[model samples]
Target: MPHLVLLYTPDLETDADIPSLCRALADTMLEQRDQAGKAVFPTGGTRVLAYPAAHCAVADGKGPYGFLYANLRMGSGRSEQVHKAVGDSLLQVLKRHLDALLQQRPIGITVQIDESQAQVYDAKHSSLHPLFNRPA
Candidate 1:
């Protein structure tokens, strides 16, 4: 299970095409492969969501600066290398997508990956996965 959530200031909404970013991130997740060349994230299990904070304050609360924070959560089974690779790829995409906006405004972008530990409780109920599992 891999879910990417993006939280950003409402001020950036006009310049940030969040829906487009979500599509890009979801596509990137589906492209990741393990060492065996198997998909790192199931096609039907990948999710990218973005939410704009209705009210917030940037650093020092003195400027028109904005911020975007990306957090990716996934089950723990992959090696550190895989995690790093995935994080790097995502950061690159985010940076590339916001390059133009960054040049025009003062904004902070952060990306982080979180892995659920073995002992953590997890549950899932979905009819979507079966659609992707159909026989080819």
Candidate 2:
């Protein structure tokens, strides 16, 4: 699984365009693969979500500052290049999408990519894939 969680300040809600940002990040990971050209993260397994923080404290005091922190969690057995590509791709999307808001207010953006062991990862699901399948 490739899960991207974006934690952004509520002040950005007006201009952050969170939905589009999430889609961009998810598309990047779903379309790209590892150095060996293996699609470890399936399209259905790619997830990108956003959370707007109502209360936040930034380095530039508590006025009009904002922050966007992203965490990308993936299963183990991925190449370092893959991790770097995913994180960098998402980070680029965040910066590019929020460029105007960032220029207006001091905003700090960061992204972290982490891996969890396959043994520790637990998954349970039903046969609902067909419902989400797209028509050709």
Best by TM-score: 1
Q: Which ten contiguous residues of candidate 1 have the minimum total lDDT?
A: 115-124
Error of 1 at 1 (Å): 1.8
Error of 1 at 67 (Å): 0.7
**TM-score for each prediction?**
0.94, 0.85
Stretches > 4 Å off in candidate 2? 60-62, 118-121, 126-136
lDDT of 1 by residue, 47-71 (tens): 9989999889888988779899999
TM-score of 2: 0.85
| Top lDDT hit | 1
Please, what are the lDDT tens digits per residue for candidate 2 over residues 42-71?
777778889998777788585788888999
